[model samples]
Target: MSHDFDLNSPENIADPYPSYARLRTEAPIYHSADPDLWIISRYDDVRAVLRDPDRFSSDVGGLESDPFNPGLEMPRWLTGLLSRISAVRVLLTSDPPDHTILRRKVSRAFTPRRMAAWEPRIREVTTRLVDDMLAADHPADLVHDLAAPLPTTVIAELLGVPTERNDDFKRWSDNLINGLLTGGPRIPMVRSAIAISWFFLRTIRRRRRDPGEDLISLLITGEGDEALSQWELITFCILLLAAGLETTTNLIANAMLAIFDRPVLRQQLCANPELAAAVVAETLRFDNPAQGLMRVTRTEVTLSDITIPAGAYVIPLIGSANRDPDRWADPDEFLLHRPNLGEHLAFGSGIHYCIGNALARIEATAALEEIARRLPDMAPAGTPTRITSPVLRGLRSQPITFTRTKIPAR
Candidate 1:
């Protein structure tokens, strides 16, 4: 198997499926010497790594290291500052015991009943955003106007943050995600993290004085000794904000792009609006928002006849695994009603599976349903711009045009 895979290459970034397919078939476990990382592309291999965390640990500090400064050769003061700001021990980066406890405490806030209750608000928000887009102009950038803001607003409401401050939240999330994705600069990323930390700290203090029916309050007042510390609470808040906003934003935008690419499918979805959920599922399988995640080998591990030394970085290619030929009949094609769509490793597997999976699905389903119902004839007005990052896969801007639907009297 050839080891020339370069994740940062322009060609690969633009369309990774081709490279992923070759890797899956030729080298399910390939090592790249340039970055000193192992790539796992097979569905079973990726699933196994995620499930057996005992062998493949999630405590890889590289997950949070600055992609720009991987060597940690910065000045002592700067390195210390980065460490302080970036040392977030959230569910995504913790192992069992700690992960189990954090997950249990956080699960209390995302009950099925609560998610069901959020559906109406999600629909209302979607309708309003689409209404604004319809009123303004044709060729509106849906990514910015709708797909992006909707999730930020939803997560803000869930976190009990003031809706009026949603723009601020969006800025913070964009800065953090862009920094992590492109390794643009260290200062802005550190500053954004610090600012978000201070905001959450203040919010936590306020919630202590005046408790509210929100996630912050739930984390603050846990059962027995399971409550989170101030730092943990702050880290958890930032984690929820970043994860909930970025993933769902990408899901909605990516689903829109995929559906619009196939006019027949788009029309079919519009005619039968209930199939919106199928669109979401198919999108997750075909073009997952999170392309892959990094996990380290806790001990020597053998995958696909390749022996990976202990303490080595392993990347599970979720996007590639979702489209593995062995896993699906027509792996690359977007079939809305694919029976195995739910089996994709999009939300990951095992205990580390996305806690906000339900929320993301609900939000995406609402967005798709509203778009199909209101803008049944929506069409792409220009080429969609894709976000270029090895880890995050999504559209940065999608210009779309549609006939304005009249809003009925209240």
Candidate 2:
């Protein structure tokens, strides 16, 4: 299919669903130059790429430029440095035995028992955030006050960081994550990465010497066949902090962003707080936090008669797949009560599925239920702004107002 598909265009970044619709219909396995990638947009095709890790390798690093914007390509040495960070090849970026070992080393931290133990604290944090938002007279920004802080606090607590250092941790995560979406070694990101890496290394070393009952301590204290190296621990901390903070924040903010404009939906949520889970499920399908993830072809692979060469970058558009007409009834509409809603690829699939998804769900569900319970009449005070990244998707700011004001809880 000869079509003009620019994955990084500002229009696509702002709202890529239209272009996604076109891709799924006309070219299921479309390839584009500039930022050269084999874009897989169909539900089944994207699922296949995700399921078969052997043929589609996840050991992707050395990304030179914004896969969406080729103009921002970095210098050769800069790209080489960025590639080393990518080359760490642990967890999501690593494949097979390495990934298996790394995942196993840290999997205990996210056990159902641990999460259930953490639920009360999650609710406590959520209620405090919502209360503070409600107590304020002027409109509150969900992204800043509630959504961001809730996850940031929980993840910090999980990692055994002092709550006083949450802002520092968040700033560090923000810079690194923004750079990740852009790719390569931008000078600012490089500097920030160095600072963040140094911070993590120092913290890891300290925790290893004096281990605590935190996830970082758990990763650092591994002393058997699956023991993670120092660098691996550093990488794990970075991934856990970045993923846990941003994704849950995005999930809560995105769900509320959708509900803010739709009064009926808001009313429904207020009417039945149990529907908060349903709201979360639909938001993930409608406007997920991440649109796509990159994978390299282990060998030449074919989908829809299009042969992708070995080592080529394959992008499975999760947002596009979630909206595929073949898989969804009204692919465009953000309707709740979706029967097959649980099947969406927002959390991804297979070995690399989001390790923090269970936590994200717990956080978002708690945030939503509390928001619905507390600010039943919350409405948009101004336009909500979305984060501008080719890979990540969520609101950067969500200003909102509510009719009822409750006394702030201590």
Candidate 3:
């Protein structure tokens, strides 16, 4: 079986699912090019590793054995420079008890009550964004008009950043995240680290002076040692910005593409607003924002009769898992009526499940529903440009031409 995976290749980055399917069937655990990291494409194997973090460590040293470690790709001096900031603020990169503490501390801020209370605000924001897009002209690129700003605005609101400065925050957040996803030298990464640290420290100082009703302010006064450490504060802020920005950004873009791919489904969705959630879930499964994640083994483990040595890098193909034959029925097809849609690992599983899953769902649902309702005539304006990054999958720009709808007067 062919094992070469040119992650940089435009073809692979744009639609690697077909390749992933081939690998999952022919080589469940195989090494790929560029550091020859071992990837687990089968749902069972990937799930096992994700669930057992003890055996498959999430630590950096563990990453040394992985094929795609930046440190391995960088010069010694550059690697040393990048090592200054190794702390992971969010739950995704941590493991076990520590992960539990940090997650619990922030989980309070994501309660059902909190989400429900924000529904009206979400709807208002969605409506305002749709109105703005209409003003821009019908068939606007969803990425720039709706998907990008919606989450950034929400994240800024959460962090207590003044709405006036939200634009700057969004720019900085995009730079920081793009740096991480696109493999490269450590300079951009270092700069991102500095920007994040500065942003959080400044925010913390302000919150101390005059606390507000926001996540950052609550974080400033939250009880217990689990209160985000200074380092965690910076990483968390960056995490919030990046996760909030990219995940939903790709989701909305990918959802739009999926709808456009199948005009029948698009028509069905445009006709019914309530089916948005189901459509969103199917979209997630169909073309997830995140493509894959890396894991390092702490000890030798057996997956699918293959013995992976301790410290080997494991790539969990999320795209493959969503379409795993052992899991979903008619794995290749998109079925809105599919039962147990929530079981899909689009947000992942175990301790590292996405912290922003609910928020992402809300954003996708709101954006898609509003678009379907307000701009039923919307269609792809031109060839969409997919972003180049193995970790993220979505259009960098999706130009669309559509018949503009007039907003009703207040």
What ordering of candidates by lDDT runs from best to worst?
1, 2, 3
Q: Sorted by TM-score, highest first, which candidate order results? A: 1, 2, 3
328-395 per-residue lDDT for model 3 (tens digits): 89888888978867777788778788878888889889888887888777888788877777667887
Backbone N/Cα/C clashes per model: 0, 0, 2
The superposed Cα distance between candidate 2 and the true structure at residue 14, in angstroms, equals 2.7
RMSD, each candidate, Å? 3.0, 2.8, 3.1
Score every model by TM-score. Answer: 0.92, 0.91, 0.91
Q: What lDDT tens digits, residue by residue, belong to model 2 across residues 151-219? A: 878888898887676778777777665565544346766676677778878878898789888878877
Query: Which model, 1 or 2, shows the larger lDDT?
Result: 1
Q: Write the per-residue lDDT of candidate 1 for residues 1-410, one digit (tens) a residue.
A: 76678886778778899999999878889888856889999999999999998999887654434332343333122223333655445777789887897888778787888788898888888888888887885568878889888988888888888877777777887776656554445577667878888889999999999989888887899668667878778877777766777789899988988887898998899889899999999999998888998788989999878999998889999999999989899898888788777789999999899988999999999888888888888788898887777667888888888877764312
Clashing pairs in 1: none
**Which of the numbered candidates is closest to the native, going by highest TM-score?**
1
Local distance difference test, each candidate: 0.81, 0.80, 0.75
In candidate 2, where is summed lDDT lowest over 10 consecutive residues?
74-83
Candidate 1 Cα errors over 4 Å, as ranges: 62-88, 137-139, 405-410
Best by lDDT: 1
RMSD of 2: 2.8
